[model samples]
Target: MTTKPAIIILSASALAMAARLATELDGEVHGLRKRIGDDAEVTFDDVAAHLVGLFREGRPIVALMAAGAVIRLLAPHLGDKTREPPVIAVAEDGSAVVPLLGGHHGANEMARRIAGLVDGFAAITTVGDIKFGVALDQPPEGWALANPETAKQVMADLVAGASARLEGDAPWLADSALPLSEDGGIALLASDENVNTPVSGLLYRPKRLVLGIGCERGCDPAEVLALAKESLSEAGLSAEAVGLVASIDVKADEAALHHVARHLGCPVRFFDAATLEAEAPRLINPSEIVFSEVGCHGVAEGAALAAVGASGELAAPKRKSRRATCAIGRAPHPFTESDLPGRGRGRLFVVGIGPGSDGWRSPEVSQMVAASTDLVGYSLYLDLLGPLAKGKVRHDFDLGKEEARVRHAMELAGEGRSVALVCSGDAGIYAMATLVFELLDKADGPEGLSDGARRIEIAVSPGISALQAAAARVGAPLGHDFCTISLSDLLTPWEDIKRRVRAAGEGDFVIAFYNPVSKKRRTQLAWARDQLLEHRPASSPVILATNLGREGETIRVVPLGDLNVDDVDMLTVVVVGSSNSSTVATGDGRTWVYTPRGYARKEGTAMTNSFSGDAA
Candidate 1:
């Protein structure tokens, strides 16, 4: 997958140009913290460190700075040209654009694209691009080079005044400035087959072949892979020519199908049963058994025909192994992922974006949100995503529609779209992860999860929870054993909430109260505080954390006896210290709370042992 570029700016002066580029390229803006304002999506404290990090993440970098500066910053990290992403430098005033590295691997093209947007000059320095207006080693989209090592010598020979012969159709090469002749010194062969070309020639594989697959639930990955390879070998087709691995949507999460795609180094796509059934007339081996099983007459043949469209033909008929079937289809022209009709395996990422700050959000959560096609959550939670939410199809729900939000996300993923079910804090805590599973467990009864929904791959990415954020803001109130209880009587009965609070007091465990209070539910906080006071002293510390990581953030420590319900709200998390917890006033005039974990007893024992040894 191609990642969106990171437009890095150093000062506010470049913010305007960076914004324009970001919009044009569909990229994100990263700026220096103090120099740039809120217009920049992300802020960085260090430039070199940030650039290196983006480079390592394999994200293209478009720095609106001097070319020399970017070159110097990325010099040490420049080793593998093949593995590096495009790095471009654009003049802050939008006058000049330079491709600093990865010239063949998209840097040159990106620089030219930016220059076009700014009406500036793209400083393309690659000799192949300048001479023939094409890079043989780095073919355009929908084409793969079989022998890249031969490109360097061939280009050298061409530069030394050698003519080339075109074996097959390739408009980009034929239209270039390359000197072509019927019987030239070098041959450029473009074919979808695994052919034996001349030693001095270049073999280019056009992406016109589709590998359609079908397998049992627990089919061995090796068996599927071997069958696919054997089918391609018999058809005289190259693996590099395989554009897509397609199957029924019901097998979206099948391990064997994914393994086949990975082995062929191609993306896997899926078609709904109804869509596949439409291609049943064209199937070479349509079966009624398959129609009864999956609502499709043929899994392999029908999927292959659907991918190739009406103008194409099957290169190979259905070939079956022990538990898997494979078929190949050839399209009239090369295609990309966007040209296909169906989607890939759907993925539902239940992600926790952390409290609110970008710093607190986990990198894994950021990556998942970035990769998702749609975002589903409460409006406030989706808004907290900030720049990460840009360009995504958002499905916002009201505060009270938790079940509706999860159901919508699951259904969206069932349609072969990548959906992110957004949540606050850790998703597995009291968030939507549990609700998602609950609905899935009851799929047969009331929730009625579709087969496609059940087949989607589900994952949970943990985030920094509210309890951890509150404890970090304060001292070590959670240093000892602790338990969390929700004081909201809406879900659980008031008697049950009070019982848990009383049990926590009897156990002398530090308690963190979630959903502490609402407008109509103010008495629960006060009641919990009174119950905890009966066991611990009235002077025990209680930390009230409101808007933990967002605006109007406040952290206050008060005596348990002085805690009032008016000071708490639904947004506040109340943490009451245990009986052994103590508050100490440090030299900095800050009061820190901590509970002893019995380390003092170990220290005293060690001292007594040393004294006894001295006396003996």
Candidate 2:
């Protein structure tokens, strides 16, 4: 949920419905400026652009609008389904919720969750969701699917009415609606076997093995490994099933135990002696010497049962070398997110720095950057924060390699490192946040990811947008109503940009043109100017702000009729006022641009005696 920005979009007439949806989903409501309700987080004239902005930011959108409207708006901008964010559309009357674009990417789940808010049904289109009520490849919570490919074929077999064989001791499979038979057509085997399963088998690996080891202070690593491996082999257990290694805390750093864990590729855990002692009754063989030294009757078996919790079964009794002892216990359920820390689950922070200025940076963004072990971004952006980059490993790429930069950051994070992907402006707005999500979506963590990479946590810290900075530089040019449209059509089509600009103009909105003019691309701004001129007056105030929030900042206001196109560059933001905007001259002879918020002005109300009689 933290990874994706969830939003709800509605029209002026649906403010009441938007309120309920926002409260239930913990999301923001986007509507027109005229609908100033408690639910509105943002308001704009061009609804399609607002929706596209959310989509580009990798946000999950629950739009309370007609399906056809959303479809037409999204039709041109739709990209890869795996990378696309969830887009759900609900009727204004709350009759039903439909998963539109990203059903597998969690739109169906989001739709179902929000459906209960209005007592509506989720209109799921996927066959797996509609028939079986769950994605067969996507395992249940807390369970990891060992072979996602096998599950697909197995499910296909069952869907075709062929008998399937359900093996192992998973109790849930008994109640499941799987087409089961002893004489197998397809195999759904839930076992702790370390050996590879047949291609025809959908192996559901259970959290069955709890390896207990008690090693001497200077025991040989070879002996510890041999003993643990022999014990697992004697009990016919798979090494992958060994979810934990339980022993006394004093043995936490024991080299032999560490070597044993490294061999099995699991974690080494410790419980105090007294906690192990309480499990003495469950131990198959109690030790008086162990009790006297560590206050536990049994170190191996006792710790094994303790780690597996109360609902565990003793799978392996005690086995011993000359200096070490081992035991195994089977847990009822598989290992979960809580157990992942020991298994090297990583953390990634996508941070925005706000228009190349430190003063405008958020505290949370700074803290995250300070805490990061590795910082990744464009070399110039990294150079802007020279002080923060000290002592941290930095991976800087040239501009236009954003995908490579984000990919490198994810790789570092997946390796159990704390990484920060530094981006300019708000992380969600035209930055790396969306790219990170798109890569994660392609990896299909829920469907299948390596155990270590599967648990990596993702978060984004926002920064001030360049448009806001430009708007603030000039006085209140964005006070009443405004929308930002990027003039650089590198990723977006020129026709789409024109359509959005035309929409903003027709609605009489204050327009903020970002990436207005660059060296390579220069015609879009002129084209936009011509299109907007057809709707607005020639004397509309246009605020031109360049190099804002940085050194050598400059701001000027020009009428739309005389906007200097040659003076504007990529670093400049062009804000064109609506029909209601006006300019005022101050005593210093400088002018200010402001748009009225429609507050009622006092009729004929002025100061009676202020300028002439100061000291009466």
Candidate 3:
């Protein structure tokens, strides 16, 4: 779960308190629309549905309302308490803080923290927290509860005046106010072993082990996972003890390494070659061949030592399958995410923001932009992100620098930074997604990508393209067979483009023309218009959608015979209808274009009659 909570306020009265909490918690304020001013980060019309949606997404929520109201809204969705995120209800006047759900999962702590900030009382009602000052079911970070089902009975006994004894090394628990005795009735065992002796008390596993892995390019994920499990079995260490998976930076994009980390239920971190090579003296099986390939003497063992720090030791020697290697390092104590030194595997999210409109932008694109540490795009594309662009490192490029933007995004990710390469409309349609792969495909050429850049993970999140937006506004222009063609001859030869246009026209495909015209380039759109008229009727409907999903947007339809190059620009998408397409005037005196997909042929068929009867 994210550390940043969602501070939800329902009225203007709670706006000041919500703003204070948001600033203190590094959270975003979600306010009720029209009830609060623009000071809130986001405004929603429906409070109950929005709160439930945030709860379902596992985001911690700090709602400034009555505790009963929050409970009433979320009562129907409540089930597993273990999986629910922290839900706290703070009074609108900031006088009281009540943890209504997930009391053991940081809710109580957050309540107390917020109460202290507002000079109010923390109404923590959990018996175990009040008596022992610790939640046995939900242990601290980097510690896993081996048997959580037994925690309720154990906590009940402890709350019923039964003393407990600590049986292992746990510095955090040692400071808690639990009634500890040598011969107590209940025992708390903390160990890295896979204990399965039906303990009478809670069994916790301290995550002190770091699993290091390395594999050849395109290694099998199953092979790496099996080797990791076998190495853990041989070392007598529990999988719960693995706090992190470490590897050299060059294997950051390796599928097998990520698969193993997922199987182990831990995050994966990567060290650069220089950092991994610093542990050469401690590698159990150093190899010069490994150094020649990835600049590290031993990928598995060196990464393990590099992650475990100098005081740690190699708990398990290097083990290998056919194409993968695994090693284990043990720290003296459990470690959390902040304790790890190396950066996580870099990821490049190539996302399309969808024509400068928040309504047209997809939720996935918004999430990708939120998760990114750096935003790389043309200046206009980045500006379209609005509130989501706050606090992100922006790298703006001018027009005609497509290769430069992609290369810079890849380089930033190679250094273990989360990057978002922003584009307009759909990322896969005439956008940066193709350029990213083009560079990756030529990673070994004279002016190719760096070794680290070649290994960064890349994902493309699509958005509504200009063709789809234009087609939707004009009504069904792309409902039938269609193709998209770019008219710019800067990258491709004009002869080839003309060949595609002629083929599309002959094939009776509705064509959406992109890059229809530029300031210096002309005659292409007019020539194409004339060429398309040869195959189709001169009365064919042609749509010129300009500045779609933005200010000063215009959608105009003209005949194929009247399609002048002066009406088209770089921002306009020209859609020429097929030979069989038609336009009709509605009752409201508006023109609607549509291409019939042979539905009229089935009008008298039995299948159509049966569907009509079913609808009736």
Candidate 2 residue-wise lDDT at 201: 70
In model 2, pairs of residues that clash are: 194-238
Which regions of candidate 1 fall more than 4 Å away from where they truly are? 584-588, 595-597, 604-616
Instruction: Tell me how far the alpha carbon of residue 219 in candidate 1 is from the true structure, in angstroms, after superposition.
Output: 2.3
Better of 1 and 3 by TM-score: 1
State the C-alpha lDDT per candidate. 0.88, 0.75, 0.87
Ranking by TM-score: 1, 3, 2
Residue 267 error, candidate 2, Å: 14
What would the per-residue lDDT of candidate 3 be over residues 217-241, giving only the tens digit for each residue?
9999999999999999999889988
Error of 1 at 566 (Å): 2.1
Enumerate residue pairs that collide in model 1: none
lDDT of 3 at 539: 79
> If ranked by lDDT, best first, what sequence of candidates would result?
1, 3, 2
Q: What is the alpha-carbon RMSD of candidate 1 to the true structure?
A: 5.0
Per-residue CA lDDT of model 1 for 517-570, tens digit only, reads 887877888888888878988777888999999999999888788888888878
Can you write out model 2's per-residue Cα lDDT over 44-123, one digit (the tens) per residue?
55687768877876778888888889899989998776678889989888888999987766788888887888888889
